[model samples]
Structures are given as C-alpha cells and as structure tokens.
Target: MLLQTIFYVAIAAEAMTAALAAGRRKMDWFGVCVLACVTALGGGTMRDTVLGHYPLTWVEDPYLLLICCAAALITIGLARFMEHLRWPFLLLDALGLVVFTILGCDVALEMGQSPIIVIVAGMITGIAGGIMRDVLCNDVPLVFSSELYATVSIVTGVIYFFGLQFGFPGEAVIIAAALIGFALRVAAIVWKLEMPKFVYDKELR
Candidate 1:
C-alpha cells in the first residue's frame, strides 16, 4: 500500500512539473502531453522493472497510467495559470522522494528482507530515475548535487528500519521516516546544507 501510494504521488508530481514547464516553453499541445506522461511514468517503470515486476505496475493497472495521462493533458491545457507556482513542483518532487524511499524500505522489510538490503533498495528506488533523468537531460543529478538528497533518503530508510526493529507500528514508521526525510530535504533547500566536499589526496597527485 505504501509503495503504491508513493508511486502514484510521484506520477502526479512529475506530470505537474512537465505540464508547467511545457507551458512556459510554449510547447505544442502534443509535445506537452507527451513530456508530462514521460516525466510521470518514467521513474516507477524503472522501479517495477528492477523489482522484477515483468508487466509493470502501470501495465497491470491501466487506470494508473490513465491518471497520469489525464493529469498531463489537463495541466498542459491549463499550464499558463500554473507558471508562477514552480515552487510547488519542487516541493512535490521532494515529497514524493521521501514517501517512496520510506515505502521502499518498509516494503522490503515486510517481505522478510535484510535491513541492509532494504536500505540499498529504498535509496535506489527513491533516486535512481532522477539520476537517470538528469543525465538524459544533461543536468546534474540530485544525487550529485550539494543538497544532501541521498543523505536524507538514506537516513529515512534507516529510521524506518530501526523503527520496525523497535516494535513501532509499521504505518507510524513509514510516516515518521517520510516526515524526517521531507523535513531534511526542505531544510537543505532552504538553508543550502550540503555534504562536505571531498578533499583531494596529495598522495594520488
């Protein structure tokens, strides 16, 4: 349930961003719609594939894809009105990352996986596509940015695992982890927090 919720939320967010960006760029109607759909569905498709879900979640449930498509189309048509709310797009993306990261770890734990593996999977599911998208778009990946994006996701997954180990309620664990990750992400964005830069090794030089 957690995973599904995160997937849908991500789709909605990406579609919104795509539509808004398309409108600002004055893209044609078809181009706008296609970009929105791609943004929305791209990440989750990779996730499902990595998880070994052959048909993929959107394929198994056409309505899910339809929701993304409809959201894209509607937003594209109304993009002009949304041009001023770009901050909402950033928030949505961060929110989705937090939720999805938490749920990824939680789902892994529920499936009787090891904590270490859960953490790794959760981080990958959370940011792998964003990394790919950034590369494809010739932009820096959030993973490589100074915003502590992966750190936040990593900590959230750790929190969820530890919460579960401590006998906390599963739903509470998921929510708390999501909140922590989101809070950290927002703080990093607002305050410009980042991981320390790596120092060059004089020996290697």
Candidate 2:
C-alpha cells in the first residue's frame, strides 16, 4: 500500500515537472498536457512495449492519464511559484527515480526476467521518460550527462532485487534502497559529481 501510494505521488510529480518544462517552451495548454502525459508515462510505455507487457500502464489504469492531465493543469495554474522550488523538485525527481526503478524491477520479476533484464528495465523506467521529454523540449537529455541519475537507478534496483533475494522484508528493502538512491542523487547534485565525458575536439585516430 505504501509503495502504491508513493507511485501515484511520483507519477503526479513527474507530470507537474514536465508541465513546467512545457511552460518553459511556451507550449499551449494542450501541448502542456500532452508533454505531461508523455513525460510521466512514456518510460513505462516503452518498457511495456519492450517486454511485451500488454495494455500499457495508462491503458490498464485510465485514471493515470487523468492524474497526469490534472497535475499538468495544476502546474499551469501555479507556474510562477514553481520556479522557486527547484531544489524541492530535484528531491522529488530523485525520489521518483528510485521508486520507479523498484517498481520496474517488480514488474520484471513478475515476468521472470533475468537479473540483468530487471536492472535494465529499472534503468529504462527511471530515465527514458526524461529522455523523451528532453527530445520534445529540444534540450539535450540530462540522463546522458546528468550527475549519477541512471547510476542511482541501477544501484537502487540492485539493492532492491538482492534484498528480496536475500529474504529481507519488502518494506524494509524498499525504504533502504530508496534512501540510499535518494542520498546518492542528492550528493551528486550538491557536489556536481558526474561520469567521465568523452570529449572529441579533433578527428578520431
């Protein structure tokens, strides 16, 4: 029940953040809702398509679409105040990344996917929506260069999967994994920690 509650909150949070992105682009209200739906649901949609999971998440639960659209509209109404909540949004985004990863792993486990595939699913769920959002917004995708975003996803998934395999209580595993991933993300942001980038100024040898 706790997990499910957090999942709904994360979905709405994702939609709200995506709505803000749409506002930054000066998108019309319709465009704002569209982007919100895509950014909040696109990752799971891609994951379901890849895994042959039928009906997709929003299709399975149409209310999810309503939640996204409603969140987007609320964001549109509160646009000015949102600009001052960058850090809070970042924290929420970090929380969403870990929660989504754990949820994705659970889906893969239900499908009897291999461990690697489970981790991959978690990573996809954590980052792919942001990638799609960036593409639509005409900005470089932050997941490609952001501070330990996908890394946190993978770490959270690993901890989640192994914790279950080791017979830990589900609630304990979820909280531990989420706390670790969230702290890692917050640290990365504060310290500006990033993966090594390959810079190619000249032609390759």
State the lDDT of candidate 2 residue by residue for 83-149, as single tens digits.
7989988888888899889999988999999999999998888888999999999999998877889
What is the TM-score (0 to 1) of candidate 1? 0.79
Candidate 2 Cα RMSD (Å): 1.1
Model 1 regions more than 4 Å off: 1-7, 20-38, 198-205
Q: By summed lDDT, which 10 consecutive residues of candidate 1 come out lowest?
A: 129-138
TM, every model: 0.79, 0.97
Show the colliding residue pairs in model 2. none
Error of 1 at 191 (Å): 0.7
The best candidate in terms of lDDT: 2
